[model samples]
Target chain A: MRYVTPRKAAVGLGASHTGTEHHWWMTVSSAALALLTPSFLMVMGTALQLPERADILLYFTRPYPAIVVAIFMTLGMMHFIKGSRIMIDDYLEHTARKVAIIGFSIFGWAVIAFTLFALARIQLAFAQAI
Target chain B: MADVNRGNRPLSPHLQVYQLPLAAITSIVNRAAGQAMVAGLLLLAFWLLGAAAGGGLWDWADWLTRSWFGFLVLLGSCWALWYHFLAGIRHFFYDAGEGLEIETARMTSIAIIAGSVILTLLSLIIYWI
Candidate 1:
């Protein structure tokens, strides 16, 4: 058996081809999150401190906060779903892996859907007020 | 023919046989932190749903998140998020064939721990002030 070099693995020049793709996916997504997480945290951390519900809604009503939350949620959960699948593959066998993958996929998508919907509603409230 | 009935299990020695290195520790903790984030994300979904279907749900979620216990949980999750995030950045360098040397791995591991703590505390300061 031959060991694949990391360089070849990264560029898809390796004997086993799929590793490169997964590596790239995780790399790119993680890089995106590294940038987005701080901005997202600033927006969310402020919202977390807001005392009034109406104030919270008004805060998210702004375009930058709403857009950052939406993008961050989408990307973060997408990364989660993929990362979970990799873990499941490593530790699970047969039916267990299948069930876990499905469960995580649903959970990730559900979070994305609910978050985007809520952000949209908050923005709509602001629109009505103006 | 060789003895077919002989039980021969060729097993690779695992954690029990080897000392856990900093890199291994970081990798394991990263997986754990990812799982923690999933749980945190579930809580977030409930909060968002409360916001979307506001009567008193949003207020209730807000109340819980503002409570002392909720604050503690949020702080822990915040640490998890940051640790996982920094560890992830280290992994990117790994994938690019940059940080596999022993010293770099140790340095990055320490950075992940220190960076996460600093970032979490900074966020808290920003929140309070």
Candidate 2:
């Protein structure tokens, strides 16, 4: 019933030298998101209700909403990158898996960057106006 | 030595062989919900980018979101968000060595499904009000 070969057991290597780093990051990010999700939802929900584009822009200028969006988008996308990688690994193989993992990771980061840039632009505009 | 009888060893039934339990369905749905939320994130990005750019881009983005199709997509995203949130909580508890019992797990799965639906409806209702 020995699954490990004698020579292999002697060498004792495991899948990726990283070892639980992915799991650890996922756990930490998910825990943070559990706390952040409600506030993030509230911020987004409020922003959506604003009547005009200017009002929506002004809404994000507030400290609370801006901060919530910043943290949530950053951490949420990082969590997504990890989660999607696991999903891609499970269902995809070879070139498809590698391409998907790379593509999704890049996409996740691009979203985070653009969203944060937008938030920053809004805040800066508000600052210059007042 | 283990290899001697490997071919004769009975393996567990594959995924399609048996009816999936509530917990399994919940688990897979959680993954699906996570995937679905990506759409929501992209929409959010679009809105933010438009807001930053202003003018036509902003108006177009605004119109798109307010459209019926956009509303439907958002509604699904809202449900997915809540579902995935609850599922994350369930997994947290599981990691803490709680709620692993069959009946408890099943009850929690049902709760996750029902709770997400209620939360989504409540959010929408509040939004419309």
Q: What are the per-model DockQ values?
A: 0.52, 0.61
Top DockQ hit? 2
Q: What is the lDDT of residue B49 in candidate 2?
A: 88
lDDT of 2 by residue, B1-129 (tens): 555656767778897787798999999999999989888878888888899889999989888887887788888998999999999999989988999999999999999999999999998997888
Residue-wise C-alpha lDDT for candidate 1, range A1-130, written one tens digit per residue: 6597777557844654564676678778888888998898788787776676788788888889888889988989999999988889899999998999999899899889989989888888778889
Per-candidate TM vs. native?
A: 0.85, 0.88
Compared with the true structure, model 2 gives a TM-score of: 0.88
- DockQ of predicted candidate 2: 0.61
Q: Against the unseen true structure, what C-alpha lDDT does each candidate score?
A: 0.83, 0.89
The residue-by-residue lDDT of candidate 1 on B1-129, one tens digit each, is 976875678667686887788988998999999888666566666676677668888778766766786778778888899999888888777877998999889888989989999989988898889
Name the 10 consecutive residues with the lowest summed lDDT in model 2 chain A.
A8-17
**What CAPRI grade goes to candidate 1?**
medium
The reply for model 2, stretches above 4 Å from the true place, is A1-13, B1-14
